[model samples]
Target: MLTTTRLDRDDAAVLVDGAREKSVEMGIPMSIAVTDPAGHLILFEQMDGAKVSSIQTAIDKAWTGATARKGTHVYNQLCVPGEPTFGIHNTNSGRFSIIGGGLPVEVDGEVVGGIGISSGTAIQDLEVAEAAVEHFLKVQANQH
Candidate 1:
């Protein structure tokens, strides 16, 4: 069997809005994005005063997490003391940036999507993403 599932604009928008709101609530500007299971951008937004560099980074985080079907930084957990992918910076591509702030979005415990937020400090970025994920899980939980 073969199948593919993608996040719609509305769903993506909700994530962006949720992430952005949380960023604002916490007094930090942010660049937020949602990616489909294939790691393609579904929705993206930049809050005022956010840096441009955050966009690519945010999308990369989401894609890495979603495609890997694990935390974006799974590599870090698996890497050796000096593994090339260890403490990977922006250079490595395809599922690297596992330093928190990015998470896979799942349904029935299977990752079907992901959300990424950047433009703030690492802690702030992770907080925003975490809040969004928590809300998403709650919504899904209520559905069943």
Candidate 2:
């Protein structure tokens, strides 16, 4: 059998903290979700003033990123009209999204989990998610 890395509670907390820091810096209230490599939710948070509707979207974004093993922006490019992955968003009961704000967390080039952010503009969401992933990577690097 093959082996894979997973995020523990502390790791998930680190990711959430990173995303929250970026959201605060940008003055954007956000819903943040972190998911395991198998696309199961590990942690989720909605900041004050964040939209309730974004809760599900944030979870779905993390699920998509974890399962797809790439940033959602890449999926956006693939799922556009005339692309090879067109109509992908229509699958998974519409849970799949090709939007920005989803990013996979990698350790030594292996995707261990994913982070998603919502309740702001697409760019803001993406920034927060990226910040979380970056923080995760930095912490991993320090452990070695």
Candidate 3:
């Protein structure tokens, strides 16, 4: 059987807190979601004043990142016109997204989970998600 790192509740909480801090620093409310490598929801949060519509989008972003094993922006580049993955969003029952703000969480070079943020501009969301992922990596490194 294949073995890989998995995200536990404490790890999920760390990611959520990191994302929340970045969102607050940026003065942007956001919806954040974390998911396991298999795309299973591990935790989710919606900041006050965040748009309700972003809840689902955040979850879907995390799911896409975990399952696809790539940042959503990478998918966006691949799905552009005349690109090899053009129209790839049509797969996975349309659950995949090519927008920014989705990122895989890696531990020792293996993806353990994914984080996604929404309810702000794409850049803001990506920044928050990236901040969360970076914090998680630091925490994991210190644990060793």
Question: Which number leads on lDDT?
Answer: 3
Error of 3 at 80 (Å): 1.2
Estimate the TM-score for candidate 3: 0.96
Q: Give the alpha carbon lDDT tens digit for every residue of 1-144 in model 1.
A: 987666677777767777877888998888888999888888888888888988787887887778767765455466556776555544445345766678888876667788888887777888899888777666657758
User: Native-vs-model 1 lDDT?
Assistant: 0.76
Candidate 1: residue pairs that collide: 73-98
Tens-place lDDT per residue, model 3, 1-144, is 987888999999999999999999999999999999999999999999999989988998999889999998889778988878999788888879778999998887888999989999877888999999988888888999
Residue pairs clashing in model 2 are: none
Tell me the tens digit of each residue's lDDT in model 2 across 99-142: 88998888877888888899988778898999988887788788
For model 1, what is the alpha-carbon lDDT of residue 17? 71
lDDT of each structure?
Answer: 0.76, 0.90, 0.91
* C-alpha TM-scores of all predictions: 0.82, 0.95, 0.96
Clashes of each: 1, 0, 0
